[model samples]
Target chain A: MHGDRLLLGPGPSVPYPEALEALTRPVLGHLDPDYLGVISEIGDRLRAVFRTANALTLPVSGTGSAGMEACLVSLLEPGATIIVGVNGYFGERLCEVACRGGAEVVRVEAPWGSPLDPADLLAAQRANPQAALLAVVAAETSTGVRNDVAPLGPELAGTDTLLLVDAVTALGGTPLEVDEWQIDACYSATQKCLGAPPGLAPVTLSPRAVERMRARRTPIQSFYLDLGLLQDYYLASPPTYHHTASSTLAYSLHAGLGRLLAEGLENVWERHARIGAMLQDALPGLGFELIAPERARLPQLTAATLPEGLDEAVLRKRLLTEYGIEVGGGLGAFAGRAWRIGLMGHAATERSVVTLLGAVRQLLG
Target chain B: MHGDRLLLGPGPSVPYPEALEALTRPVLGHLDPDYLGVISEIGDRLRAVFRTANALTLPVSGTGSAGMEACLVSLLEPGATIIVGVNGYFGERLCEVACRGGAEVVRVEAPWGSPLDPADLLAAQRANPQAALLAVVAAETSTGVRNDVAPLGPELAGTDTLLLVDAVTALGGTPLEVDEWQIDACYSATQKCLGAPPGLAPVTLSPRAVERMRARRTPIQSFYLDLGLLQDYYLASPPTYHHTASSTLAYSLHAGLGRLLAEGLENVWERHARIGAMLQDALPGLGFELIAPERARLPQLTAATLPEGLDEAVLRKRLLTEYGIEVGGGLGAFAGRAWRIGLMGHAATERSVVTLLGAVRQLLG
Candidate 1:
């Protein structure tokens, strides 16, 4: 019954029909040549979607969070300095994971729902010139704010510091250029804009990031996320046995990526933007106030404050139980007072926007 | 095209039809109440399969190796001593991961195709009385060896050390009694004997193991795999958001567990035993020599030496390309000289054995 609910949440947007169909295909062994061909196709399609020529691009075998951990644990060593921009819940997690990896974390703070200032992040990097990585969430899903990764990339050019970006909600729904922006490591999830289920984290690491991982002082603390070993299994010839990669999920992802590329990446982004603007334009008229600043807002995810006197939880429950529309509740600083409406991938359609608006308007009236 | 091939490798055995059908179900948000119901059902079923009543039973988001890392990193802090039994590849990985977590590791060695003697493992534990955990692989997929776990459990009783098991290949295909065997922490993969696609790792921790994790001196290093945080997300009231668990994979695993339970656990186990014995009985006459000793061999996976002067890789490829049957080439020490044939879960049938033996008989002739 829940499967029939229209998913318009912070993640797990409605998956592509092709992806769902692909999942029903019979299982294949991880090392099966045909499965390997599928894996290779996924890699190629990922590179095109990620806009990178990096050979290390492949899906990490967990959710988006695993991708985040994979990039950090693979790059940061004990005593390494990492500058993290904190504007939302995921930004705070970056600092937490980095600190756990024994990295000295320097925080560049921005208010919730506000975009991080790239200048401030650069200043933090200047203060800690030996910083090994400068990380930012390209589109913060928790607050629907888009940090300007483009400004920070050129600033750190030719420096030892790697510019890492978390593009969990941005990869296919918005424009993300990994090589053009000089991002050393970038990770995205399949559930949001990629039009797939929430199981695989498609990640790409630049040659420099791979080099940094290989020159690590200590062995990567987490063997499961070790980039070197993962690369050996995913990219190397005569692929060595690592963990059994999920061929079932890989098939689904391959189908999702194929569908996205077939639709043209720009067209997908344009569709999300057009449909998202339609929702954003309608929210204030329905007594909801938009959270993120206009210029920095992510079109794929819209965060808005609840109408005055509206019991947020009660209204959300009513929408799900009565109207069968699922949206995300606020996270961190915005909890209980905000709702995150997602227009991602296959869910970004005129019908989704109209249906959601009609339900909210009726509830408000 | 590879989807139709018989999966008789070390893992990724043929998935159940119900599980495949479950994958076609529509995607659901991770936090949906109905989805949560499915999660709870999965937990209950996993507890039944693991034969434990531990409240912390749940699936870790990644593969079985992630489960292995989760157990090791959660309980072992820097300077802690762990005694590991290394007989096959997975056992060596246990030492590798524990070492990466900064634990001082003491390894108990055994030959590639032999089981670790319980007396020797006990001696190692006694020598390192301060060991925080003693780990072993219940079913070593690499060499088809089933380490004797029953004896070590009673011997470690009342000791400070917790017993951890890698049940990646042992869970549903063979007999694994977590509570009865006194296993403090155990982990298994879905794709192997569970008749599901490779993605989720069903892991269960005993109350004592949870206590050990809670008392850890250092924070669990891997953020994605931190057991306490994962428990908070999977089992806590009004569940906290940790990672977006893949509902698609969960559905598949849920259906797989459903089929297994419906078949009756004893009946499923008997099927595997009978099918495995049939294959093992016929291998010697077919010019293949069984690798593991009779008492220690796993019923689900049988490792065997290839006929003398026969190229293993060429013959295996012929079986795959010509007969649409997949048998694994040996791993580690057995590489190039042996093959690993799996009779697990849905693939454990007399028909599978007969088809495989007939194919081999023709190929050899």
Candidate 2:
């Protein structure tokens, strides 16, 4: 009766059993030839997944938040002028990390369920022409709006300002052209659409980003997140090991990315869109309302408002406790207003979509 | 004949099968009651392992290097003065990370295979009395020199300067008295003597360190290594889930730390000592010379000068290819001359020690 259960959470979703097995594989030294071979494969996969020819593509040995920290701090040195696009909880978080890095941050604001217009962000950049870096979230998981970074970077074209992005939830489930978009430094986590366990963060640096880091007036204020030294470890010849990456994690990410590549990136995105469509269409029938505007929605994720009288916390508890189905309630500004349902990786399936809808329908009945 | 050959490297050593098995255990959500309980228990065990009564003990979701960055960057602000003890490769690394945090670094030099004489370091501190922090490695794994951090702080007692210690190779294998020594901030990794695979770093900070961070005029420049926000995330009532922890990595570390605790910290350290003693005593018989003075020696690790006429790299190659054993060659100052034999974690069994001794003997003949 119970072989496996579908994972339908905002994140920390279920991984393929093969990915789980990758965690148990015999641990090898970080610098061992066999492990380096695995790491080399990881770099290629990270580049393909990031969709960049950037030579600095590799995993940062930390979690999703670490990814955010690495990208922001390494790209913008202390006192560097930057514009942070704050639309959701994650964007606000970017502002915090950027502020901590001693950047003079100018926040380009859009309220929680709304996406910032790329044109407005460009206007702010023009007004604050001293801004050397522009940061945005390609997929704002907190509010379920997939900001289009591709067109946004074009407006910053011909300017020395580098475009950085957080693609933590969008890599496999959504189409992101890092090169085509002219995004400078981008980082992502393994837990979302990759279906790998959470730990390592994949990151890339455009030549412009690397060049600016070299020319920075101040050292990248973090040694660990300093891409300057990290480049020595991850991108240098002989591939000097920086941090001890649990080689086991790279194995799982390798396996997860393998599955995604086999499935074809386009098909993976299409699958997410279809499953998201199914859930989005069915949730309204169960008396739920989608949070973000339909046009700007992320295909792999959905944020829905609870029915007028239903207790959001109570229903979330009941879903986890009674049904073993997991989901995320609203975060930060949207607290008590929206439930985030993710159709990431192995969780993006017709069965999962139908089952979650069925479970909510019965609960509503 | 078919059993897996043992790993006796500097780190990522062969973990016990049980430890590897823990990695495959189904991962629960970061906030799952069961997972949180395990994380809490690991914290308790780490405090015991670190011999710290500090209230801020917890694991950072990164490697030992991350632990290093977490400790250094948390309280260090732009323009802070820090004195770093640089003896070998890792100490130089510490200086680099600290300098990147915008600290004016004063190097307290100790020769490779020699401990940082407390008197010399004290003189440096007295000269730089306004230094905000003092950083030293208790166990300098690069040179197999275990410095006495025990007395490094006594001279600066009652001063405002915080004592920072890196016990990456010392935490579970050597004597570390964080409370008795008045260490304000200390960080350790999981892979070295802890018997866990390398992934997360368990760090502890005294109230003084927290107070320092709280009073910082500038923000902790590195966001990934920022301890202030991480403290709120790890210690918040009903822990705020910031990043999805590698639940299995945490679980495996819990199991390793649990087993280490059950065996008792004193006994686990004694085990490393006894096995290391066997390797150290047998080195002369293999025509290898011990590097560090007996009194300054790290009992869990032995650095031996390669035999004349033997290319250390050649021997290491044969050892890994033939015996499936991996040991470290010297880095930086000692490179091409010495080999580092580690009796770390589950790899420190008497049988493995005797086996390695015998292998070196055979190769020598």
Candidate 3:
């Protein structure tokens, strides 16, 4: 029953063997001393990876979108104003979540396959001075655009607006210095560059974000995603039970993090950069074109525009069924026009690049 | 790193070998045909287990609490009236979730280790005529009390009050007829009686619950837990991308549910009843008494009161460190007074009962 296809899709890249083995470990009670130790170690390791000493660093029990919701729902109150940068799918999702939270959303846009401009966000901030949060996607999974988060700090400076970054496809693959970048809240999933099975969402909230949530006049709507209670459960001495956390998934995430940290974060980033560059360079030789500009492209996710005559869905299926390779079709604005190929974590290897390139050549050539 | 402890705690009983093996299966994309097949099979299997033909029956991506929040946060809008029956920890949580959702909560109460009186709910329903939801825990894990849900159908027959049951610890271990009992919405976890590791929450929503959610005046506060979007992703013709569902966890849940269905749900329930009776009888012979009344007790969870002067924490610690056995310490109002032993699914066996009994006699004697 095990489907052994080469994972080259936008997420759930091939997990490290040790990490997959961790999933097979005997399940422990969430509060068991052994399991608690795993949770504590994961938190510490996550801080190191995120390059932040924020004590609220831990994995949420759901996937990447859950992390996004946790940040927005906790930091924004109903009637609060949030400035969202819309350049790609995940960025647009931030606007939807903000609107759902009853926040007045001011969206600053760039083209779908391009990075968000800091000047646009600055203008949005000036136009909506009451904006309490500026949300953007650090790495847009849909279009593979990597937004430069460093400039946003100075752009929204001297304002109480907290910066929330969706690091879903960026965290382990790119240089995401949360503390150095001055990001208030950032969330990522394990399936992308972390090389873990999809489940846990690693989220780090700055002291500022925590304080903002603490000062909220209204309680966060969903008790399951409440950051305050989650932090209490993860940080409190003799941690309180906020929910019954999945100790099995936690073990897998911890093992995955351990593998990454062992590889050195810089080395992992360099590997993804190398593999992604190879895929981008080789695909065009097989008649595929890169969608996003090179400078703005994410090393973890590469959105490649299909050749005019090639049917995107048909080719993707052939790659899956014929070559046993999996890659994502485009989403939203880029739908049917592009294909998203992920070079992430364990899947970001020369062999994967060669295998996918050969398969594309076999079918498309 | 695999801690080999006997899981006799309130939940997360030892996963069946097949379920554990399923977790080790190669990961697939969430939208992969193989994975969608798995998801469909799980939905069908869950309906069989839940004893409902409700088309909305499927597992939520988060834990049991996520399922609880999904139902409450979806069915009740801000300022909606929700009367919650609080007889144990989970019931109190229902109240808290309702209040957090901006609902006016009217709590109908009973003692901690007892079931809520059906008459009290009818009165609460009379007092709060506008109440849109009445939530209760079918099996209270904290107190090991199983609330009688059969009478709830007739109590609110003529009203628009939808019943939301937290069957986190009850399903697959007891007789729960979702359609027959006219439950509006019900949720349970993959662990506990399902014999899967804790991750997915199986929730079934009746047509009434779906209609109520569709009629909501306000958008559901939680974008992650919204049942409407989730249904589209799971049940739609071409499933939409809600979030990246964990294929690994889905495989595990499917394998676990298959084991249950293969054994027959009635047989699974009967096995739990027999095992629970054995533990209840044997524990008293060793001078331990069950906290919950026999008639209202859950067969899967036995909250046994400790003998006077015996510190609950110390004894629990000894059982763990000395015998590699894990039983839950008391929670909420029953804290420091009882041990919650779980007999559910693969863990509810003649051997498990004997092993736990032998371990307790060794420690307490």
- What digit string (tens of lDDT, one per residue) describes model 1 on residues A66-139? 99999999999989999999999999999999999999999999999999999999999988999999999999
Tens digits of per-residue lDDT, candidate 1, B1-365, equal 53588999998899999999898887888898889999999999999999999999999999999999999999899999999999999999999999999999999999999999988899999999999999999999999999989888888988988899999999998888999999999999999889999998999999999988998778999899998998999999889889999999999999999999999998899998999999999999988999999999898999999989999999999999998899999988899999999999999999999999999999999
Candidate 2: CAPRI quality band: medium
Instruction: In model 3, state the lDDT of residue A248.
Output: 87
RMSD of 3: 1.2
Off by over 4 Å in 1: none
| lDDT tens digits, residue span B77-179, model 3 | 9899999999888998999988988999999999999899988888899888899998888899999999988889767768989888899999999999999
Candidate 1 chain B lDDT trough over 10 residues, lowest sum: B1-10
- Greater-TM-score candidate between 1 and 3: 1
DockQ: which candidate is best? 3
Worst 10 residues of 1 chain A by lDDT: A1-10
Model 1 B-chain TM: 0.99
